[model samples]
Target: MPSAYVARVVLREPVVGARTWAGFATMCTGMFIAILDIQIVATSLPTIQSALGIPPDQMSWVQTAYLTPEVLLIPLTGLLTRLITMRWLFVASVSVFTVASCGCAASGSFATLIAWRVLQGASGGTLIPAVFSAVFLLFPDERQGIATTIAGVLAVLAPTTGPVVGGWITETLSWHWLFLINVVPGTLSALGGVWLLTRDQPSGLLRELDLAALSLLAVSLACLEVGLKEAPELGWVTPITLSCLGTSMLTAVLFVRRTLAARHPVVQLTMLADRRFAVGSALSFACGVGLFGSVYLIPVFLGFVRGHSPLEIGKIMLVTGLTQLATAPLAVALERRLDATVLALLGFGLFATGSALSATQSVATDYDGMFWPQIVRGLSIMLCLLAPTRLALGHLPPEQIPDASGLFNLMRNLGGAIGLALVDTVIYGRVSGHATDLAARLASGDGEAARAVGIPQALFAAHAGEPADPATRAFVAPLIERAALAAAIDEAWILIATLTLVVILALPLVRRRAEPTLEKTP
Candidate 1:
């Protein structure tokens, strides 16, 4: 068995005499609120777009607005930890997010809402990793396994519950309710953060902030995130796209150089050299891709292709979320007896398998077919997330825990951005390719025509929603049928390829160490 080691050292000094569940609960509540806000806006997007008259092309920015600040701020977390007391930061972040939520609700234009979301994300970005560090530091070494388990469960659950909450608010009330709903939790968390969290000021020259690096870091990440988000809509080779990309790359290079030269760097570049940390961050990146890609894809499939309501998607996701919650303890328990590396590998395998299975979905597939994949995927994530985290920080000195956690979380967030972009690009390309190919076949005077392929002319006729004489119907019917089938196949193949890549990248990171049995704590 690996020796029990202090995973975190509280530099600020612990105010509470001993760790209690209440303390953990309070810490997690802050994290829960932060993550909940991240996802709650997702299901409400269509409603927001319609009510605000947002262009379809600009609709994605609502999400990007939040994600951009969040990703950009993640690396800065370690620096923030040194610069400010955790208690003050937590309270400030919660307050910012709450106010931003209100701003989002009250916004009259797309630009205003996007601005609020950026503020919300920037504040939220600091809160999450800080909370994780707090939890690790609050608990003793012996209880870390349990603490990690609890933390993992909350992380998974917040996002899982988001769709359901967002859907309910969007369907039953105005989309504004999605933002307004956060007010209560946000207020409570802010108050709780101030009351429950102890404060201590860090000493020495490290307390001084690096203004140059901070500015460069923010500009670099903002440009990069905006570039990635806009690249799909703006032609990649366009002057604007090239400008954004160039600016992002240049700023990023400067940020890195500035950090290395700074007396107290905003982000510690040295900690990344730790093999466990490096490997874990890489795995987290891949996991982020699979996680966020599915989060985006599943609802799109259900609502657009299957014609399900937001409420129905929420209901299905609720089931999947609950299953993940239920499996958290089991996964944690299993981790004790297994090497974290091995567990992560197994988890990723299950996730890839689940994605592969989901790729086989069709218009005729029902809830039953969908439920199993979600269940497997949920269990897989529980195993995958915690193990990589454990493996990454396991060998690090306690003082470095916060730095490692921040970087690990940052990579995952960046991975989500990259994954979503990649998947969307692939699906769009494939769909267009398939559509063009299928259109050609339909136009060809071949024996295996649309009629020969067993597609009903009426189905395509209904899709056009136009009354057609037999001549018009015959000409248009085959094209519509071919297009639908091609789109479906294109989507499936893209997901298949995505999952395959995830498995391929993840395989090497699995640990070759012998499994150790976890002992129960009293």
Candidate 2:
């Protein structure tokens, strides 16, 4: 009995009190800025493209460069934390991120900018899992709710407010400031992390690092990220997309097999065998689909369909961010009192409804039309993040938390990647068909089609009563494309909502947390 109890005991005790909280907050801030950089740069890509004289075709590489390394490095953070203590790992990451930000600001060309972005992303990738792992390592189980709330707020909030922040920065200060803004925050976080964090001795795990597995992981994630990025534009079945995805799959299989057979795997895939963690991971993925999909959707609609500038779009999108801020406390409080599964169900249900509500939007829908759906989604955001987070990482022993956090967060990111691709696929695939159908209807004197094409009734009568002149068709072409885009975006909304709802079906399979039989010894 004593031997069994010894085996179950936490190897490291949770750090307590004010200093640890400050240390945890420092890590969270680092994470926030890292995540914020992604959105800030994303929203202002056009400005950057124009300033750098990058061709439109090549502009997306700026983001793709950052995202690929980010995705690849995220799952490796556990191994990194083991090799270097969390404090040093965070400080090093922040330093690299800060310096890379400077490089980004000084870049004279697209190639230079993308090179710096890759470094920025590689370092930034560790910040998220580091903070999450800190939650479990730094706080006792009872206090984890509040800790997670803090991290969760920033985690969700960065992306929520990123567009607005990016838009404002580009409009007022220029795109350079987007990367420059991280300097002070990143530096301070690093310094504070060094001062406040309790140091843990390294496990001398460096010698055991498996280079082959590392190489495989790098190839798999890089290919997968590039594949997903290009799949939307080039079509999923194209040679480029297929080759990248196929390589990712084949390498991923080898990596998994190698990991499972190894005594000390880089990432702990065996965690999936735990029913609660597995279900929680699935829920996390669904939440990602909604979170990232909506962020991408709203901006595209405002910018393309409504012809809103980035600044104006950001202002309109503030509805979601402000609502999230207002409801955050309520969410944190409920997380403490509510059943994790029940809270997750409620959150997902609201998210699905919110997504579905947005699908009802038309070409003419604007801020007033989008307000309530954003509100509902904002209200549910914290709930979605907090509940599944607790379900996934809450019950795990301290030693396992780092690897578990990496895997759990990886699922969310993967969901986001796949979801965005699907959204793009829907919009790009169906827009032309919608335009053709609308054109035929307009030719048949359909009033609704005329309205969608924005043709005046008198003008529509002229066009429909006779073969339209080239001048008239030319005038109507842009309007037809706009209406078709709006229709396509609506279908994409329904796709994400359905995905979120479908995740709920697996909730029943997760077992409830078993009651504790032994108190954790200090």
Which candidate tops TM-score?
A: 2
Q: Model 2: residues >4 Å from true position, as ranges?
A: 1-15, 456-463, 518-522
Q: For all the candidates, what are their Cα RMSDs to the real structure?
A: 5.1, 2.1
| Top-scoring candidate (lDDT) | 2
- CA shift at 52, candidate 1, in angstroms? 2.8
| lDDT string, candidate 2, 1-522, tens digits | 355555544443564889998899899999999999998899999899999999999988999899889888888888888899888999999989999999999999998999999999999998998998998888877788888888988988898788889989988897899999999999999899999998898864787888899899999999998998899889999999999999999999999999999888989999999988999999999988999999999999999999998778888888888888899889988998888899999999999999999998777899999999999998998899998899999888877888898899999999999999999999989999999999999878898888776778786776566877898789989999999999999999999999999999988987877665765566
The deviation in Å at residue 475 for candidate 2 is 1.6
**Clash counts for the predictions, in order:** 0, 0
lDDT of 1: 0.72
> Could you tell me which residue pairs clash in candidate 2?
none
Cα TM-score per model: 0.85, 0.96
